[model samples]
Target: MHVFLIAALSADGFIAKTVDQISTRWTSKEDAAFFAQKTKEAGVVVMGRTTFETIGRPLPDRKTFVYTTRELLGFPPELVEATQLPPAELLAKLEAEGYTQVAICGGSQVYTKWMQSGLIDKIYLTIEPVFFGTGIRLFTEEITNTIRLKERHLLSDQTTVLEYEVLR
Candidate 1:
């Protein structure tokens, strides 16, 4: 399976102003539409607990896997599942279930975890024309990797999507 991390960030590199801040609040509509299109095409998404909570529901048309130990109560069995497997194991399970591509739609914690796991093959980041001087980062912990630029998509006049191959 091809696993990639996806996130939208402020121009200064923060993902959100606070833990509970919904992405749609700051991200452009074009970014939202782009997100929906890609994740829908992937058919599966994985995210941290906080990210799932902020969204408050399983994303329609895609199975959501929350990477946490907390029992995911109140979510439909078919739409959501809780997982604590390491990045490779989780990817294995999803691939076994017939998903070709997996999107890591995350909060900082999850982003760091997957990046450190060294399994992410690509990263898709939408940079919006906004600045939050201080906020949650794209990754909470220190990580180093060489990513080669693969594509640059101009979603709008002010919003751009950068795609990179996460070279191992």
Candidate 2:
């Protein structure tokens, strides 16, 4: 299955001002609109529990899989809140459910894990024209891999969205 990771970060590569402040407030409206459109077209959206909590709800018309090691109680019926499954296992399940692709949609930890596991096929990153001096980065751990730039688009708000294919 094709798993693409998507995120909007500051020019300095920070996803948010802080871990707890993981919202789209800093990103431009164009970036958010692009994000929503891509996620909607995806077969399913997968994110870490913290990321899911930040979102606060499942996206419409898409199955959202929240990966957590903790015991989640009273989750909304629309979301699939469960413990972390291996990337391959998760992809297999998604494929069996007729999903052609999955979108890894937030938080540094989740992005790092998937990238480290070599599951991300491509990345759609929108770089906003701002700098946070210091904050939560796009990846918590080090990832040393090459990516071929597929294309780039400068949004109406001047945010640049870069699409790259992971070179594996």
Candidate 3:
């Protein structure tokens, strides 16, 4: 499976102020539009439990897999599929089902876990023009690989989108 990650972060590399933070609240409109477009094009969307709860609902017309060790309540199984499988198993399952692309949205832990497992293929990051002095970072675990820049786009409102291919 080709796994790509999409996130909007502050100049200081913070994705959210807290685990329950609503990302759209601080992310720019341009980034929001880009995220929407990317997610819609993805064959599968995967996120952690906290990220799924923060999003509040399943995305329409696509299968969303929320990876959590424990079961989640308040949402029907049809709307979202909760899985405890590790990244490798999850990717294998998706591959068996014929999925070509996977979007790894995050809550820091999930992002780091997948990267540590070398599952991420590309990264699409929107650097908002603001700074959160202190907050949750994009990745807490250390990733020591280089990524080749694929594209850069200057969005309206001074937002910049950077796409990179992770060199494995």
Most TM-score-accurate candidate: 1
lDDT of 3 by residue, 1-168 (tens): 679988888899899977888899988877887887888787579999899889889888678899888877777676689988889999998899888888999879888888888879899989988888889998987988679999998888589999999998
Rank by TM-score (best first): 1, 3, 2
Write one digit per residue (lDDT tens) for candidate 1, span 1-168: 788899998999999999999999999999999999999999999999999999999999999999888898999989999999988898888889999999999999999999999999999999999999999999878889899999999999999999999998
Model 1: ten consecutive residues of lowest lDDT: 86-95
Please, what's the RMSD in Å of model 3? 1.3
TM-scores for every candidate against the unseen true structure: 0.98, 0.93, 0.94
**What is the alpha-carbon lDDT for the whole of candidate 3?**
0.86
What are the per-model numbers of colliding residue pairs?
Answer: 0, 0, 0
Residue 144 alpha-carbon offset, candidate 1, angstroms: 1.6
Off by over 4 Å in 2: none
Model 2 residue 9 distance off true place after TM-score fit, in angstroms: 1.0
- Work out how many backbone clashes candidate 2 has: 0
Best by lDDT: 1
Arranged by lDDT with the best first, the candidates are 1, 3, 2
